[model samples]
Target: MSSVRSFVNLIRPSIFVHCEPIEDPCGPSATMADLN
Candidate 1:
């Protein structure tokens, strides 16, 4: 479960980068805060 979470964390940034302009209203920095 933790490994899966970590993998998701790794992949999320890439997706976030691509989708950020379209989907992320709060932006990557906010997402990073939530992740932590």
Candidate 2:
């Protein structure tokens, strides 16, 4: 979702440097926590 993308974008320049570009591919519960 766009909301998830926005969250990832917010962190992309910092802690997310080594993260994948999967876009919440891991599902809602975990992704939601990570997004927050």
Candidate 3:
């Protein structure tokens, strides 16, 4: 169960980024390019 949850957690970020990439954090410095 724990492993399944971890796997879901791993895939979740990618799914979220695909859903809303602009809202996802890129790095230490946020870029306006993402907004554009």
What are the per-model numbers of colliding residue pairs? 0, 0, 0
What are the root-mean-square deviations of the candidates from the true structure over C-alphas?
11.0, 8.0, 8.9
User: All candidates' TM-scores?
Assistant: 0.33, 0.33, 0.33
Q: Tell me the TM-score of model 3.
A: 0.33
lDDT of 2 by residue, 1-36 (tens): 556667877977454433445556665566566665
| Residue range 1-36, candidate 3, lDDT tens digits | 555556767988454221223454674246655554
**Residue 16 of model 3: what lDDT?**
26
CA-lDDT, candidates in order: 0.55, 0.59, 0.51
Q: Tens digit of lDDT per residue, candidate 1, span 2-26?
A: 5555676798845432122425777
lDDT of 2 at 8: 74
- Ten-residue region with minimum lDDT total, candidate 1: 13-22
Residue 28 error, candidate 3, Å: 46
